[model samples]
Target: MTSQNKSVPAFGYEIIRDYALSTILGKHADDVLYWVGKDIARKFPCSDIQLIISFFEDAGWGTLSIEKEMKDGYIFQLTSDPDLLNIKNRKFRMEAGFIAEQIQCFKGCLTECYDEKKEKQSVVQFTVKWDTKEKIG
Candidate 1:
C-alpha cells in the first residue's frame, strides 16, 4: 500500500494544532516565513499540524500551510470563508487565549471578527501574548 493508506486520516489533536497555528499566521496575510512554537505545543494532548489542518479543512477552514524555523517555532496559516468567522461564544476565545498563553512564547492569535456595517466587510482582531516557558509549556 502507498503511504496515503498507512495511517488514520483524521484526529482531534490535529484539529487543535491546526487551529492554533493557523491563528498565528492569520495575523498578516502577507507575512512570510511564519513560525510558531511546536515542541511545547506537540504535547498539548491532541493533533499535530497536518492533522489539524485536515480537521479544520473538514470543518471548512479552507487550505492551510505551516512555515517552519528551527529555533523560532513555526508559522501556521489558514485561508477560509470570510463570513464564517465564528467566535460566537466569547468563552471560546477565552479558552483559546488561555491555551495560547500556556505555550512557549505564545504569540497570541489574531481573529478577524467582521464588523457588520461600512459598505464592506471589515474585520477587527485581537492579539493575546504569553511565553510558554513561563506558563505550562
Candidate 2:
C-alpha cells in the first residue's frame, strides 16, 4: 500500500494535537487554531454545502448534518460515536473555523461561526452566520 494510504492511529493523532495546543500553543491556542482552520478551508475550497458535509465525513472529523437554515446562515450538527469523544475543545474550534471560512469564501461574504458542545449527546452544534447584503469578501 502507498504511504499515503496508511492508516494512522486516531489516539496518537489526538494526543499529539492536544499536546501541541496545550503545551506549545498555550492560552492562545484556540484563537491560533481557529485561524489556522480558516486558512485550511481556503486552501481546500468546496463547491457546495453538501460537499462540506462530505468533507467532514471523509476527513473523519464527524458526521455533519444541517440542523437548520436561515436567510443569514446555517446551523450544523457534528456527531460522532462515543469512542471518539475524547478530543479537546480547541480541536473542535478548528472545525468550526473551517466551516465558517469555507461558507464565507463560497458566498463571497463575511461569515462567523460558533460551536456548542453537548457532552451528554456526544455532539457539537455549529452556528454559522453571514451578512446577506455584504457579499464582498
lDDT (tens digit, per residue) of candidate 1 on 1-137: 97545554334434544464456646542222121223223344233445545644554434444534334244343444443433231112322332232332333333211112111322223222333344342
Candidate 2 residue 117 Cα shift, in angstroms, is 0.5
TM-score of each model, paired residue for residue: 0.32, 0.90
Residue pairs whose backbone atoms clash in candidate 2: none
TM-score of 2: 0.90
* lDDT tens digits, residue span 1-137, model 2: 88647767988877777675668888887788789889888888897899889889877787999999999999999988756655343357888889999899888888999988887787889999998878864
Which residue runs of candidate 1 sit more than 4 Å off their true CA positions?
1-45, 80-132, 135-137
What lDDT is obtained when candidate 1 is compared to the true structure?
Answer: 0.35
Q: How many residue pairs clash in each candidate?
A: 14, 0
Candidate 1 — worst ten consecutive residues by lDDT sum?
Answer: 110-119
